[model samples]
Target: MERIKAIGIDAGSTAIKVVGINEKGNIVFYKVEPTSFQMKPQLEKIIEELPKDVPIGATGYGGDLISNATITASEIRCHSKGAHLFLKGPGTVIDIGGQDSKVIVIDQEGEVIDFTMNDKCAAGTGRFLETTAWRLKTPVEEMARFAEKADREVQVSSVCAVFAESEVISMVAKGEPMEAVIKGLHRALAKRVASLAQSLNIIPPILLSGGVAQNPVIKSMLEEELKEKIIVPPYPQLMGALGAAIISMESKTKVTNR
Candidate 1:
């Protein structure tokens, strides 16, 4: 069995990400799941699959809920740390999460120097896209590819997710092409997130993380809007968990060296 040195858990608003790493800073095991109302039991089930007795680090909105964690940190700190590990240079980190979207500027050391987030509205989040996809009767997985085939994207006027849904449905009723509508939706989300990063007056390479990074339409639109290259680390969705696990490994090593 591969020896586990530490583990990190990100109990985010919409998903739970768990990552275990060895002493060499390599991921040994990882898992992602929708956030369950019974998070304790769900987490317990995940932990059971991991190697026992490793130090655990936790982050995200529900980090404190992990009673067994040896250390805890905020999502911003952890994500920046994790991105730095991969980026190895100063850059902006734009994470489009399930419930919120954030733009963070990190120095060459990977420390977060400036950051902004929009948690008050679902305007620029995964939920917004999901709701729009449902209205279009399309799977979220296919939205990007479908949008890519459109010759021109229709403009989605509403900024609010609820209003956007209504607008999309109306367009569908009017015989608007689904590809055009989906592309427009992607543009709307990209612009919303772009504003946050632009507020920092920071430049590329923009490192994108979170569940939304998987969407090609959004990623391409964001790059065009920012006029900069975007960097996506491996397992972009697991960045927070990976960061937490890295911290735990460092802490455990410190104790051993002492």
Candidate 2:
């Protein structure tokens, strides 16, 4: 049983993340699955696999759907707590997920001070990369490699994800190198996210989380665009679920103490 203390679930739009933590707030069990249309049963099945009677903290766009959750938190709160748990201090958090992107400011005590998000469009999200990958007939996993080896970036001028694909097609038609176009896509996405982060009061020790954080080209370009070093956790995509578990543990402990 590993003496599990709490559980966290991030029922994201594109994927679901579940984390089980021991008393020390360290993850002992972790799982992720591509989101299915039948989300409720999927979530319940995962919850059933873990130890019962422990507090469950839920987050993400689908967090509210977890009828069995002990507590549900916002994506902003989950991300802030998750980033603070890893950084162990106040800083800025840039989370780019499949459907949206958010920049949150965390204060010295690991509280959310301010935040901004781009969920109305796909321009600044992981969806943009997915579209680009499909258009180029390149696997999403290989885009970073092409970008890293590129000698130059052929501009992807469209600010909209749909239009950006047209721009990419034009470049490819003109014989632009695949690597150059891929690098350009990364640059465009980084610039878009950087501008979003700069919209708020950015603090130092900036942390990057979410599935997009795994992209090396995106990470490097973000650092260059924002002019700050970016810190990424070992399991960037699992932050939301891990944060939920930690928050639930803390809250339960507080109640027991009182």
Candidate 3:
């Protein structure tokens, strides 16, 4: 058998993100794929592509499905650890994933002291913007570009996924520009996300993570609304997995030292 390094799997609501770390604690490789209800086969397929000899850790909403992992951690803890590992200090963690958005307050030691989550609805998460984008016949990946072209944002009126769709359609009927509508949708979601972040009462440097962090539209809007700078890691979407990997490697050290 070949010797390998630590691995972390984040079975999130919208996607599965995995990261492999070398012995020196640097990320060596990573992968991300959309989640499916038929997750077992999809997970097995991704695992087959990773080194099999390494200790693995798991996190996120679907973490329990990773029954083979050496340990499992909550998405909140994993994201906090991942952000602190890179930031190397105390700060707030704003993770805007697909199904939910959460603000985590972490100490310099990478421990979560307080957190606020918005899982009761999709209005505060990526799913809200995704639904609006689909209604506009715009691809989710292109939303940032579309919003960037607008000179101003129209009032989205409501952030609820269902209501937002109707609002987008009404704007189109009223000859409103697509850019304004898209920007409005982004702002709508940003306002909800900002509320969650404010609830944590934490300050910058705020680290942004999760798949939705890739979108500059929401990021910029959140910055403008909150008047706070947001720091995004290199692999913004893989933070959860990175944290899990860090814990996995540390766990191995504890065992060896013992």
Candidate 4:
């Protein structure tokens, strides 16, 4: 077994992710759990199970919860690094997290040169779909299915998640097709993130990460809205943690070389 050289934890609003990396910066092991109201105990237990001596890097909204991390980095930096690990060059990274959406522009050297984020509201995030899913009494995953199957979609005019839900209700009341409504909601969310991606002077090789990347509807809609092909890693949700682990390994290697 390759000895784990570093560990990274992403304590996000929707999920907590832990990843261990070998000296070659390969992910050797990983664990993911739905975040609970009390995260400290869950994080502590996960740490207790891993190699205690490995350097730990933490990122995400709840990153500060990990008091003993060797280093803590912003999600923009971590996501950019994680995407770069796969892209290996300049690109734009769009991360539609549970509660926020970030568009990061990475330089040729794989460093973030500019970025934009939509954290002020849920309209531009996975939570937007989640909220609409709840309002429609449909599973979030099933909502994507509904959208994909729709022949055509209605317009979701509101950019506010709450207002969008009300708009959805109004459309449903007006006899709009459920599938059309769902598809419209997804298109609206994708457009919001796409707008963020366009806020910066973006480059090629666009990548999508975070849990939302798994939604086929979102990926397709984003590609349509941005008019660009986007790459989604096999394990999109784990990128933040993987990036942190990569950073840990890189930092450790640098120190040893010095």
Query: Which stretches in model 1 have alpha-carbon errors above 4 Å?
Result: 252-258
lDDT of 4 by residue, 1-258 (tens): 589988999999989999988888888898889999898998888777878778888899889888778788988889888899888999989999899889999988779999998857889998899888999999887988999989999999746988888989999999999999999998899988888888889888899999999999999988998899989998899999998887766664332210
TM-score of 3: 0.94
Q: Can you give the TM-score per candidate against the true fold?
A: 0.94, 0.95, 0.94, 0.93
Cα-based RMSD of candidate 3:
2.9
Evaluated at residue 103, the lDDT of candidate 3 is 93
For candidate 1, give the lDDT of residue 185.
89
Model 1 lDDT at residue 135: 82
RMSD of each: 2.6, 2.6, 2.9, 2.8
Clashes counted in candidate 1 amount to: 0
Q: Say which candidate scores most in lDDT.
A: 2
Which candidate achieves the best TM-score against the true structure? Answer: 2
Local accuracy by lDDT, each model: 0.85, 0.89, 0.85, 0.88
**Scored by Cα lDDT, where does model 3 land?**
0.85
Error of 4 at 254 (Å): 11
**Model 2: residue 256 alpha-carbon error in angstroms:** 15
The reply for model 3, stretches above 4 Å from the true place, is 1-4, 253-258
Candidate 1 TM-score, true structure as reference: 0.94
Count of clashes, each model: 0, 0, 0, 0
lDDT of 2 at 32: 88
